[model samples]
Target: MAAAAATNVGNTWINIGIFAAFVAVTLIIVFSVSRQNKTAADFYAGGRNFTGAQNGTAIAGDYLSAASFLGIAGAIAVNGYDGFLYSIGFLVAWLVALLLVAELLRNTGKFTMADVLSFRLKQRPIRMAAALSTLAVVFFYLLAQMAGAGGLVALLLGITDKAGQGLVIAVVGGLMILYVLVGGMKGTTWVQIIKAALLILGAGVMTFWVLANFGFNLSAVMQEAVNMAGENGEAILEPGLQYGASAVSQLDFLSLALALVLGTAGLPHVLMRFYTVPSAKEARRSVVVAIWLIGIFYLFTLVLGYGAAALVGPETILAAPGGQNSAAPLLAFELGGEILLGIIAAVAFATILAVVAGLTITAATSFAHDIYASIIKKGQVAPDGEVRVARWTVVVIGIIAIIGGIFANGQNIAFLVALAFCVAAAANLPTIIYSLFWKRFNTSGALWSIYGGLISTIVLIIFSPVVSGKPADPVTGLSKSMVTDPSIDFHWFPLDNPGIVTIPLAFLLGIVGTFLSKERSHPEKYAEMEVRSLTGAGAEKAVAH
Candidate 1:
């Protein structure tokens, strides 16, 4: 109750110490690796020297954000069957990335996702569109990670006031900027690798401990959760508890599923990781290795979620400082008290830091390489100038993230991440798919798809129930909508997620834009891109005009 009451001052300090130690150690690793960043290629893609397994672990680290650890566990603790769907959606997304996007993107792009898109299209406009979309997606993602950090630290340190939580978010953002500015891609990769290992290992330990309490009987664990839930116990095990109440809710779930499954292939950060590995083969292997590790970790979340339900209870979790995000930490406190909570808190912090660093670097690279270098400078900038611009962009992005995270502090991080997935699926996925597989996808079509999807998804989000007009939960007395002011209702969109409408609309816009354009089809360029994408020919060099 009361989010575990900070237990004792000694325990709180211990948690802070553990978290501080992790940041210090990682900072050292970042500085040591910073020396290797001697060129644009080195800073952007880690000199393209990472092996398959190494990149795979880092990819897993990058992919598994605060949403995966803090948010999903909390979601399952509260929503039961509906909550586990996030895990399934996130894990299944990898298949789409692997089968359709990973190897081809790796073989064709040099540093950023825009590289792949601009290969056979008009370089300046296509890169600018791609860069804008990448920045928007990264901004949404960074907000989720930052919000998670705020809630998590507030729960741990018992900082309930909004100002205190806002300060915590700022601190996390500052550290993220530091990591990107000092370490670049190589440093960030190492941090991810380290964080990913710790996260999985911590989750595995907690899962085993939770099951051990039930004599390793998963069914028994579920029964205990059911009994603890009282009147709502049976509903927890059923499908309709969260999403089955109305047709609109069911439609929302479908939209959510589409976003989760299709969004990974278009996520700028995840796509950027492919360029860090050496070749198309390793990029393929990276996805395979990531799948195995990620699958195992999600399995752990199932036990952890139910374990929290049985041990900590949903009321206690929701009452915590972080709301639903407090489930896993509260469970840790319930199981092993001070020590385990400290350890888990540190790992969760690491999760946020690694992910935000990855996102910040991606946004920075896109701005410097695609927008600044390709568009503003007409590709005339020196390597040092580009890297300098990237560092400055990191600072700007980090500051913006801190402010957004402050406003988003108490929201469920997983739900926030789903919104990001919706944006990615709508804004980037259509263009990416058409550019890779459709020979007639010209510059006009790419621009239409990117701008249309990006603008529509964002506009819909602003006018949806997610932004305003949703009533407070009858039981909790809290509104799920971002704008909690009941008098300021302006939402016109009925669904919380606009993916169902926006994703299809984006794809349709791509086709229509292509046909409407009188630009001649570049059959020769398309042929070269096809061969290069499939065979890894000329991949060592970035596509040049």
Candidate 2:
């Protein structure tokens, strides 16, 4: 079924052509920007030259992953209101980032989130913990993007076999490494800005076309979708088609909600973006701009999802090469045939490449700046050496992402990203909140919060239903868990996501560790951080240092 669906979606050569052109154009932009890479600042934070509007657009590009284009639309097409919940969770997350961390993080941190975290605390231990947590979050996120890339290109090119998809993922990983190694942050930022514009433009046109077909009536479009969904069409229109099955499922939804709402502020890649702008004011403005762009794109998803359901049907989407992840591309095929599918497929590929580049740079920057320079070399490493190490780290991280993506192919990209968010919120958010807000937050607290949350979240995920124990889909006879074997039933966690339990535990551990510690936080350092974060008085000097 998937092979047949793939063959009918688009001209394989056309899709490849569009993809090749996008890569060629973006590579030129990357090399053009590479001339700016003379210092660590340029490689890590784009030399702090981007305006708020530009950074905001780039933020939209980084934030809108394959999950936004492929996963949420598919979820909405198949599950109705419940699937739209992903959009709400993602958009609302920006509010948390804007209100809680954006300006302050920009003012306080020079390169990575660890710079802010270890400011008032004992530097070596705190930096180590923060770097570990950042790598974990980036690992999960890179896995999602790589998986999306593999499935997307495979569907468009009519590649049904695992080896073909694996090769595609490897190619994506190589491109991502090149972007980081040559273009660095400046190059990656330009790619993101370009990709974000194309994505929003593509989505906007599709939304308008879909609405025009239903006489510009949202109700008519939704009604037609329901009518065509067969007996369960009404279920799609209502809530609970996916997550309201039982008490456990309801709790799982809450976990997913908490993770999505809190995760953006803690995401290492997103938080690192705050430092790319010059001042707290620009950081704040960039958040505002990002919010509006992201909000608008999500609204377009609502229309596109229903349009796909009404026009293409859910069964066809499931039988496609990428399963739920193929809805947007399939809808493009349905609407504009070969040409539109080719265009949208290129946009989707751009989306994955841009995001993976951002994540890779963030992880590499954290390792070089925080762990290697601060902890290992004791700040004796020169800027050139640091950048060289970062470039090498990018290659290593890319290799890991390619392997992980191969194993993760064919899963719902949004669901996989939600797990990454769960890890971010659990491991990073508590420490960030405490370091910024609580004056008494010490090194012990930071270490406990980072390591405790990181370990517990990973452990619970290993034992969760997402990893194993879920029954096979009755219609498709495929296992729903990560482990596909029917006899793998080791899962002990009831919920699919561990956010509900792990988030609170992390916060509690921070507080408990603070009280139990003998080392008091440096009051003078906290005062400096407060003044700098609030007023940006020393932010520029800090960055220069």
lDDT of 1: 0.88
Q: Can you list the residue pairs that collide in candidate 2?
A: none
TM-score of 2: 0.97
Q: Write the per-residue lDDT of candidate 1 for residues 1-545, one digit (tens) a residue.
A: 35455333227788889999999999999998778676788888888888889999999999988888887888788888898898898999999899999999988888999999999999999999999999989988888888777777777887768898898888888988888888999999999999999999989999999999999999998899999888858888878778998999999999998999889889999999998888899999999999999999999998999999999888877777777777888888888878889889888888999999999999999999999999999999999999999989989988999999998787756657877898899889999899999998888988899999999998898998888888987876666788776667899998888899999999999999999999988999999899999999988743111
Q: Best candidate, TM-score-wise?
A: 2
Runs in model 2 lying further than 4 Å from the true structure: 1-6, 411-415, 474-478, 541-545
- Residue runs of model 1 more than 4 Å from their true location after superposition: 1-10, 473-478, 541-545
lDDT of 2 by residue, 244-280 (tens): 8899999999999999998989999999988888898
TM-score of each: 0.96, 0.97
